[model samples]
Each structure stands twice: as C-alpha cells, then as structure tokens.
Target: MQESLRALLELQKTDQDLHELEQYKVDIPNQLETMETVQSEAETRLSDQESKVEDIEKNRRQHERDLQAAQEQVKKYQGQLYSVKTNKEYDALQAEIQAQKNRISELEDGILQLIDEAETEQETLETIRGETESLIERFGEERTTLESRLSAVDEDVAVKMDERKRMAMRVENQVLKVYDRIRRNLRGMTVVPIKKGACSGCFHVIPLQVVMQIRQGRRLVSCESCGRILITEEGLEY
Candidate 1:
C-alpha cells in the first residue's frame, strides 16, 4: 500500500482502540453505582428486620405489663368479695374478678403470640444479617475489582491515545486531518477495506474501475458515498 494509505489504516486501528477503551472507562462509574445500590438495599433490609424484632420485643413487654395489671385487679376484686354486705354487691365483686381473669387470659394470649412473632423476627433478622454480611463482602470485592478494572482501562486508554497520536503523525497532514474529521463524524471508522467491491464502512458499492484501483495498492482512494478512505484486502497485505 502507499505509505500515506498504510499510515491512515494504522491510525484508524489505533483510533478504534482508543474509542473502545474510552467507552469502557465511561462505563466503570455506572457499574460501581449499581453495585453500591445493591449493597444499600441489603443494608436497608437488614435494618428493617432489626427494627421489626425490636418492635416485637417492645410489644411483648407491654403485654406482660398488661397481664400483671390484670392479675392485680383480680386479686383486689377477690378481696372485696368478703367485705360486701348485700348479695348484689358480692355478685358484682365476683363479676369484676371474672372480668379481670378474662382480661388476664387475653393478655396472656397476646403475650404468647408476641413471643412467637418475636422468635420469627429474630430468626429472620439473623438470616438477613448473614445475607447482609455476604452482600457487603461480595459487593466490596466487586467494587475493588471494578476499581482495578477502571484503573487498567485508564492506563490502556492513555497508551492507545498516545499510539494514535504517533500513528496520526505518520500520515500526511492533510490526509490525517480528513481521517480525523471523518472518524469524529462517523464514530471512529475513517478508513475501511473494500469487501465484495463495496465500502465496508458504509456498504456503498464501488465501481469496477475504483475496485481495480484500490486493489492495486498504488494510491489512496476515498469512497464516493461515505467519503471514507478505501483499501482492499490485497492492498492491506501489500
């Protein structure tokens, strides 16, 4: 291939590499954000579980107090039964004692239910705590891996950009300018090979004469439709 055309092809390769590397670099922060969101959700779930357990425990304590107060009422009303003078008063005292006993029973049932619920909550909290720890560790490792990858991508992009600069310098100034402009406009493909007598970049057909000229590798040519620098497979080998 002609020296300028060969240099343009090399420059295109470098530019493509830089383009891909830069894209990857841009994506790293988003990856890290997603990982952080996962970790935050795990932590929030764990916190909610803990709070549920605490609320259950508090309710259980309140039920216990209610049971105690009901028992005290039963004892006080039972003591009043003996002091009552009339049948009506004694029956009222008995009724009050019975009501207190029923209230105690209800309180006991509530306390039992609360105990069961608290146990379940404790179990759930434990499970969630374990999962949270695993999530933290897993996300920690993922974040580290992503950070390392981001650093590596940065280094690779810097190297590729430096290589692109060198390759651009090898092409003729006017050709390099055109290549750079086309690359910027077309997302990094400025020079493309002819495949089946068509421009690979834009898939536009090349005339038979143009195909012959590109195959000779003696001069640089631009595609008529897309204006991308054109070469042939044979020209590349030459």
Candidate 2:
C-alpha cells in the first residue's frame, strides 16, 4: 500500500506539471491574440487620423478658393463705384463694395483658421503613424518569442503526460481507481501527507492511533473528513 501510495504521488506530480504546461500553451495564444487586437486598434486609429488630416487639407484648399473669389468680387464692386451717375447710385455702389470687402475679410479669417486646423491634424496623424509603426515592430518580436515558447510547451506537455502514465502504471489498480476518482471529484491534490498530526488536504485532525498506523506504512489510510489518501512524508520521501 505504501509503495502504491508513493507511486500515486509521483503520478499526481506529473499530472500537475502536464496541466500547467497545457494551460501555458493556451495562455501563449491568448497573449498573441491580445497583441493582435492591440495592433488592429492602433492601425485603425492611425487610419482615422490620416483621414482627418486629408479632410482638413481639402477644406483648407476650398477656403483658399473662396477667399480668392471674394477678393475678385471686391475689385469688381470698387470699379463700379467710379462710374456711378448720381449720389444715390454712388451710395449704392459704396454699400456693394463694403459688403464684398466684409465677405473677403470673413473668407480670409476662415482660410487662416482652416490652415491652423490642417497643421494640427497633420501633426496628430504623423504621431499616430509613428506610434503604430513602433507597436507593430514590438508585437512582431514578441510574437516570434511566444511561438517558440508554444512549441517548447507542447514538447514538455507530451513528456509529462508519458511520465504520468508510467507512474500511474506502478500504482495498484484499486488504489489508482480511488485516486483518479478523488482527483476527478476535486480540483486539487488527491493524496496528501500527514502534517502537524492532521490531514494536510483539509486540515482535519487525526487520532493518534491512525497517525501511528500511517507512520508504520502497513495499510492504506484515508482522512475521514476530506476522504484523501494520507501518507507519512518520511515514508514517501524521494
């Protein structure tokens, strides 16, 4: 019983190692997926910024054309003022010239504002581009490293699974069935050593008689409270 219990412990250790390696395999791909999401978002932001810059420049150019047309209108209105036939006609011409000048002033202000907006948008676009490029480069390096680690984890998991099987074969069939059943029911250690005169699995106190029985290593002993197979650490020492 003691030898079977020792073999079961070794099998459990191998199974735990295999479980960790499998989880690691999952975690690496999850990390890579996260990185891909980040890269996609960065690229989206950069593309949006570029569109903003392009729209701002397009609007700026349109404002410039409007400014030029307003200037030409002012010149044509001023020319009509000198050819006025009467005071009323001259007053009307003067008003027309003033209206065109005011429109020209407004167009000039709008063009200047558009220029400022275009400059700011262009700067933002460049910044986003730089950041996106750097992120892609960094993700590329990390992806390579993660892929390598994923392969290594696969190999380690395969080896640990084989080790678990070999160790499992050493345990008695009845004992192995009980251990596997307990492990399936619980997501933790199925076999535990006696600690401080208690079951380490659930901290349940053991009677002195049971402790003596466990120390003598004669028959299989189980903790009544947690239903865990109990062994003496000294008897199971590797």
Candidate 3:
C-alpha cells in the first residue's frame, strides 16, 4: 500500500505537467484570434464609412446635373422670345421662361445642400480611414511580439510533455486513477507534503495513531478529514 501511495505522488506530478502544457496550447491560439478580430473590425468600419461617403458624393453630382439642365431649359425659352409674332405669343414664351427659372432655382438649392452633406461625409470617411491605418500599424508590432512569446511557450511545453510521459509510464493504473481523481477534485494539486503533523493537502491535523502508522511506512494511511493519501516528512528519501 505504501509503494502504491508513492506511485500516486509520481503520477500526480506527471499529470500536472501535462495539464499545464495543454492549457498553453489553447492560450496561444486564443490570443492570436483576438488580435485578428480587432484588426478585422477596424477595417470593416473604415470600409463602411468610405462607401457611405461615396454614395453621398455620387448623389451630389446627380443633383448638380439636374440643376444645369433646368438652367439650360430656361435659356432656350428666353432665346425663342425674340422670334415671337404676336403679344399673346410673347406672353406665353415669357411664362414658360419664368417656370423654367423657378425650377432651376429649386434644383440649385438642392444641389448646394447635397454638396454640403457630401463634404461632411468625406471628412468623416477620412477620419475613420486614418484611425484604421494607425490601429493596423500598432497591432502589427504587438502581434509579432506576442507570437514570438507564444512560440517560446510552445517549445517549453513540448520538452515538459516528454518528461511527463516518461514519469507516467513508471506508475501503475490504479495509482494513476487515484492521483487524477485527487487532482481534479483539488483543482490540479494532488501531491502535498505533511508539515507539523497536519496534512498539507487539506490542512487537516492528523491524529497521533495515524501519524505513527504513516511513520512506520508499512501500509498506506489517509488524512481522517480530507481522504488524501498521507506521507511522512521524515524517514524516506523522495
């Protein structure tokens, strides 16, 4: 039983190393994705603003063309007034010319308003583009540094994993199971030393009888309060 308990300690150490390595693998990729998301969001916002500004400018140009056509119609009617024969004919031409002039005035007003809106939209587009570019540059440098650190962590995890596998092979199945159970229950800490006659694994004080049994090292003993396999601080070499 004592040998089995010792094997449990060894198994716990191996599993702990494996757990850390697994977490490291997950962390590196999550960090990379977060950086990518930030860059993508900035770019998307910049593009949307640019598209809106372009639409505004296009509408402004169309409005200007409509105003020009109205003005040209007014001019054509005015030029025909000189060729009129009777007073009634002249009056009809003059009325047509006045209607065209009013329509031109309304179109011109609309064009001016569209131009003003386009200019404001263009300024907003430029601001967003500048902000997006700045973020891309800053994020590029930060991502490089983070990726370098992640690579180093991955290499370290690989080396530790090799050592953990060797240790795992030395322990028996039942002992490994108990070690893993304790690790899961205790938040990844399965092996802990006894200190001052108390179980360091759970901080429970060991009775005198159980303490003596642990010291003899003939059979495995557990903490009365915590159910963890107990080991003495003295008498045996780790």
Task: Estimate, for each residue in 1-238, the C-alpha lDDT of model 1 and write its tens digit.
Answer: 4888888877777777777788888798898898888888989999999988999999999989889998999889888888999999998988888898999889999998999999888999999999899889988888899899988998898788888888878888888777777777775477888888788888999999998877777766889898898888565765
Rank candidates by lDDT, best first.
Answer: 2, 1, 3
Full-model lDDT, candidate 2: 0.86
lDDT of 2 by residue, 1-238 (tens): 7688878888888878887898898899999999999999999999888888888888878878887887888788788888888999989878887887888788788888888888888888888999999999999999999999999998898888788888988999989988888888876788888888888899999999998888777777889998899887665653
Give me the candidate number with maximum lDDT. 2
The candidate scoring highest on TM-score is 1
Report lDDT (Cα) of residue 98, candidate 2.
Answer: 85
- Candidate 2 regions off by >4 Å? 233-238
lDDT of 3 at 206: 81
* Tens digits of lDDT, candidate 3, 1-238: 5566666666666667667767867886887799799889999998898889888878878877887887888888889888989999999988988898888888778878887888888888899889889989988888898778778877877887787677666666666666666656666456565789799878898887887787777765666676676787763453
Residue pairs whose backbone atoms clash in candidate 2: none
Best-first order by TM-score: 1, 2, 3
In angstroms, the error of model 2 at 58 is 1.9
Comparison by lDDT, 1 against 2, better one:
2
lDDT on C-alpha atoms for all candidate structures: 0.84, 0.86, 0.76
Model 3 lowest lDDT segment of ten: 229-238
